[model samples]
Target chain A: MTPRLTAFNVVSLTLGFAFLYLPIVLLVVFSFNESKLVTVWGGFSTRWYAALLGNGPLLEAAWVSLRIGVLSATFATVLGTLAAVALVRFGRFAGRTLLTGMVYAPLVMPEVITGLSLLLLFVALDVDRGFWTVTLAHVSFSMCFVTVVVQSRLVTMDRSLEEAAMDLGATPLATFFQVTLPLIAPAVAAGWMLAFTLSLDDLVIASFTSGPGATTLPMRIYGQVRLGVSPEINAACTIMIGVVTLAILAFSIASKRGLAEPGRAEGA
Target chain B: MAEPPGRPAPLIRFEGVTKSFGAARAVAGVDLDIAQGEFFCLLGPSGCGKTTLMRTLAGFETPDSGRILLDGADLAGVPAHRRPVNMMFQSYALFPHMSVEANIAFGLRQDGVPRAEIAERVAAIVRTVQIQGLEKRRPHQLSGGQKQRVALARALVKRPLVLLLDEPLAALDRKLREDTRFELKELQARLGLTFLMVTHDQDEAMAMADRIGVMEKGRLVQVGAPAEVYETPATRGVAAFVGDSTLIEGVAGAFDGAAARLRVRAALGASSPEFVVAAREAPAEGSAVTLALRPEKLRLWTEPPEAGTPNVLEAEVWDLGYLGDKTLVRLRLPGGGTVRVSRLNASRRPEAGLSAHQRAWIGFDPADAVLLTR
Candidate 1:
């Protein structure tokens, strides 16, 4: 049943949404301001957007961030899916509880600590901290998120489907690829998108691990904001928000279509 | 149980198989054999180890001890996919993403069968199971009966040596279940393949299975043809579990070679009626025993039979259940014990010309009452 929209409910709903979205709305509106000042709304113009297009270093940083997001998210999804299947299906093996705890530990770990430890590890190993190091750091931190998303789906899936596949003469490996993977594809896709967004927006870890030519968009934006905010920065932020929003929308639509099909992901 | 005469060597044999989960023993030393071309059913209540026994054969579970033989070859380390056996799960377990045709062709594809042969076999099995028009539909889009047919087709497409069905008809409605039982039996007969099914419904087992093995508390208590098991249950537990029976405990009074007289020990009536039942072995006098009387076997007489009629007891009609096809009359003995008698409603008369608390005589032939010593 739909809840009744009482006067109190309407007031609370309006207050909650405004509290969450007011600052973002203001930022979006000011991105189109004709004034060079970031806050003043003299008039509307597309000049800031045009100026953002001409910033070479900013554009290069954005490209670096996109590449890192795609690569790390792909690696994270593969590793996280394997970890989830092992945890869920390998009932009561040695170190099971310990492995499960370690797999999820990164989700709750402070980003500063994760970043500081990775920086020390790279320093001690004497390896160059460039694109590969930043990608690896992002993968290590975002994989737990992917694991959490995919693990919940795996836990609720009907185990009998896999058993039926094996009974029908498919080997254990074949069953996982044919029966189990297709059923959990939507959750895996969602996890990939989540990791991609996380990597795209991460600043603390990227700042610590990135070196030389591996500057990400978030680090570049933070550096520019510290110097002094500009309308070009606002325009760049608006575009970043649009990209993240589209990613979220695509993930939601894909998952909703998965939910619409009955008996695809039902719990045992 | 020894192998039945005139049959070839058993197709599947469980040699003293036992399985335990932690402290709970699911199956305890079960030894059974199913011959080729026979439909065998494991009949028991839930957790009685019927499903566990079947899973041991399916290779989903490992027995703690003993061996399983298929066609005289020991199957100890064979995995489920490598075993030449297919199972139809109770839930049907159709892959929801795959279409009906894809689901049916899954097994043949695994075997690396030619693509053309896979299509032909899938089509043949679909037509055999009468699900011809549902080739492109997903599992969720089909009804329970339709999904059941697809599951059957998938399991049969590969033509396994033995087909294992775990409560195959349980998911269907009552009417559909009854019809499917006959169809499954007919299909098994035409294919001439061994079909081992696990079910708790005794009526279904009796209607379809050539032989029924009754299990209780991790043990196979009795194994026989349906008629034999019903007519001569090995113990009181089998007698009570296989069908509805009123067990009257007593002590042996006399043995006349063909039948034994049991003097009722329970105060079933003021007269303490003596029951005579046909028995193969004579029990010593005063030895404890029990008489199992089936509801349908007892005849409810408005008037007492001829004087000195054997196995006759005087009882009062406690209540009646008119169930359209038959009327069940609950009769109370003088000593406050109740026994049920089922009478066929052969005529259009709704009543049995009897009312509650009315006097009546219930009699049965000596052969109809099974005497149990345990």
Candidate 2:
């Protein structure tokens, strides 16, 4: 009976996995088809993927998105990490709960609302809403997500490590750079990756906030998909899938190496 | 190790320091003087100001009143990082992300020490703590004992003026804690640093500290060598906390030199010695007092022993526990409360004496009991 239950569980899990993955599988498989229609599966061809590389404007937009993602991710990581540390490590303060709520509130708020508010704020402040505006929007929203991720890791962190560093002649600032920051590096990296993904996939915020000459890859894709269904968008999506998969793999491998490398908790 | 570097005063001193959390005073006006190279322990029950004192020393909490002096420097405003002290957290608190080498070198690097010097010091401290060959491994790969050793190494690597340990052995198992107590004592001696350890466990404090400070209700009740604290606790709190003891409170009616007479009336007073053992500096006659006797000092027998034994009380044997080397007998005294008496199992007599519902007599020498005056 136990074996039967185990077999049943495994079968259910397999079906569940297939249900979630089947669409993505079909998308990848159809990307190679020579047919013009998305539903038809024709003979395989590398023409679309090849076309993806040669599309000058598409590649340029992708480059713009990547640059924005990298910059926003870095900025968000620093700000979010500091906010997380302040929430978790520092002593009790009167505004602590309110501050933490504000940091994490954006994670669940409507993206359209954030975009609209940000647009209004920028206009009121007389700041141009363009590539930099979109970048700022991504950073603003991503900061909260990054803060949540890092805060979860920080909450589980042993405060004694920081105290140990403090006791060993390291100031609070020094402890952050030496013990606390190094210890939470993997979480920080993970947060950055999450921030980058959020920025890369962003559309609503960018659309609401961006001006001319600030077309990101998502914005470009949105324009193409709006005009009509095309193989080019599918090709672009396939390339993204490859890049994200490779990134996740690289990150996972590096993190596992770091985990295996430390035999003991040392300072921070 | 080797006591780090010293100035010309006690490594750390608490001068009438008090710490309050909201409405509760966790540490109340504690005055302490810790000598250089002293393995001092602040011991008490939970929430009894021992950890509070340690925290004040480690700069985790600033005292609400009075000052802290470290090596003759007024440290009232000195933060934990600026203080010439380090603390090994009870959780080990090893950095989970960095390699052991990086963790050990973290403080040194933060202090702007050359990378070579940090490496050298890390290696030296790690070697001293015997955590070699595991410098490249993350904390998850290490065992609990190994983690504790690494923590010790980290705290000592920088050679702080004082090393604070907050219940360092509270996380370990019983057998492991017992074994590590000796190791910790040996480590403190070898390092010769002023070690201030906070623990709720009396045995751990007694085993590890050259001097033990007993705290109760946010007050430092007594500070002395382990034997001094154990043999003659200054208060009922210390007596009951530092070790298992039978306490009997009564008013003293008469006193004569080393012996005293009391108007006995507490629970288990009937089972107490016929007379109280007065200390050299006991309170005035007719004052209320408490008498305490350790379990190891009391002897229990199946039947009343010989005459002229001085102190004897009839009791009903209720429970029994046989430790390999000793036997603990719980006797329900006729005076209402129960008392435990531990006897060494030198021979097979304990087996013969061990029986429930048996009548027994508990006796101890007058010198074995003490009058607590706190």
Candidate 3:
């Protein structure tokens, strides 16, 4: 049975969407403003976007952030997938509860505390905190998110496929590589994308771990905001939002068309 | 069924094979011999250890005790991957991501067979299974029957010494299941491969198997030809599990080798308190025993059989169902229980001249009933 769309539902839906998207819409609109003042609409122009292209420090920081996102997401995907497999397929083992807790604790832990503890650990280890440290921090927290996404997929996977592979004369390692890995590849890809986005969006953790020559896009944006707000900042935010949105849409369409059936994922 | 000429020696043997999971025994000491080229079915209810036994043979489960022998070679340390047995899982377990051809070729590829040979064999098996044009389709695109054939093809392409089928027809619809039952039997015979199938459907086992092993609670209770198991069950549990049987509890009275008598209280009316049950062998006098009789073997009469009727009881029709080909009549006996008698509708009229609440006489031959001392 289809539910009736009442007036209250329509009103509530409209209000909820407006509350969620109004700030982003205003920022996108103001990014095209001709005036130096961000709030005032002084006719549409692309001068702020042009000025953003010439900003070397902000561009360099963005490049650094992109590299970090890609590297950390790759590492996190591997680690998280292993953790998920161990949790779901290993049945019962020693320290399983502790390992599961560690895998998920970062998801709910306060960012400041995670960042502080990571920084303190790096200090105690006498390790230099720089781009590598920032990547490590991103991997640590985003790995938890990846673990959650992949674990849910692994839990519902039909174990019979693995058994069928083994019964067909594939060894355990071969069966895992040929059957189980390919079956869960889509979820792993999704988790990687999620980790990438999380790393790109992080500011607090990056701030704690970053050292000289390791300023990320978020740090640069924050520094600019501290000096004074500009249309250039709004333009940069709009570009970041656009890139992330485009990435998500492309990922979804690619995934959906690659395998029409939700029950199975074919490796490309 | 006649044994195929030159029946090969036993292909698989289970000697005191027992497997347990922590505290519960999944497969108790099961000793069975399945000869080469024979189709054997393990029939049982759910969780009766039939699947577990099949799994052990397929090397998915290691027996806690006892040795599983294949062609006189003991299989103790061999894993499933190395076993010369292929299983068609009940769920089909087709790699959903792969095409039908890839799924069929997977076993050969895993064995490192040449690509040309693998393709040639896969093509031949697909054609043999009559799934020619479906090679390019994924499992999700195929119907239930088609998926079943794909699973069959995949298992058969390996050309293992024995093929294990776990409820092979279970996922198909009733009509499809009946059709595939015959097809699977024909395929097994044509390929000359020993087939060990596990199923709970008695009709499937009866229609396809040369021998059926009935399992109950992790134990092989009875093993025989389908006709033998159906006609003469060894125990009360096997009788009830194998088919619809009406068990009458009674006390043994007369003792003889050819025939014995049991004093059973009739189930329907209050008039007859004592009834005589003819059995092949007598239990000790005054000992409790049960009499098992099949429904189709029973004959119902309007008034009563002549005084010479051996196992006759006066009963009242309790309920009736017209099943197109046959009419099922439930009768209430003298001692307060119900027995179902199915009669073929061999006449033009649908009714069997019997209605509910009508007084009738239900009787069977003395040899039709079996005495159960359990």
lDDT top scorer: 1
The list of candidate 2 runs beyond 4 A from truth reads: A1-29, A38-41, A244-268, B1-9, B96-146, B170-192, B254-288, B301-309, B348-350
**Tens digits of per-residue lDDT for model 3 on A1-268?**
9878999999999999999999999999999999998788999999999999999999999999999999999999999999999999888899999999989999899999999999999999998989999999999999988788778777777777888999999999999888888878877887888888889999999999999999999999999999999999999999999878866775566445434543343111
Each prediction's total of clashing residue pairs, residues at least 3 apart in sequence or on different chains, is 0, 8, 10
Best by DockQ: 1
Docking class of 1: medium
Native interface contact recovery, all models: 0.65, 0.68, 0.59
Q: For candidate 3, what is the interface RMSD?
A: 5.5
Error of 3 at A15 (Å): 3.4
> Mind giving the per-residue lDDT tens digits that candidate 3 earns over B1-374?
23368865578989899999889998999999899888999999999999999999888888999989898788899999999999998888899878999999999999999999998999999899999999999888888899889999999999999999999998889998898999999998888999999999999999999999999999998999999999889889999989899987766666545445555543333453455666655567778777788989988899878888777788889999888898889998766888989998888786856889999998887668777787
Q: Which residue segments of model 1 deviate by more than 4 Å?
A: A264-268, B1-7, B258-264, B267-272, B283-287
Writing each residue's lDDT as its tens digit, candidate 2 over B132-249 gives 8999998777878888888888888878889889888887778888999998888888878889999888888888899998999999999999999998888888888878888877
The positional error of residue B39 in candidate 2, measured at the CA in angstroms, is 2.5
**Model 2, C-alpha of B222: deviation from truth (Å):** 1.4
lDDT of 1 by residue, B199-283 (tens): 9999999999999999999999999999999999998989999989999877787677634444444336455677777776777
> Which ten contiguous residues of candidate 2 chain A have the minimum total lDDT?
A259-268
Question: What TM-score, to 2 decimals, does candidate 2 have?
Answer: 0.86
TM-score of each: 0.95, 0.86, 0.94
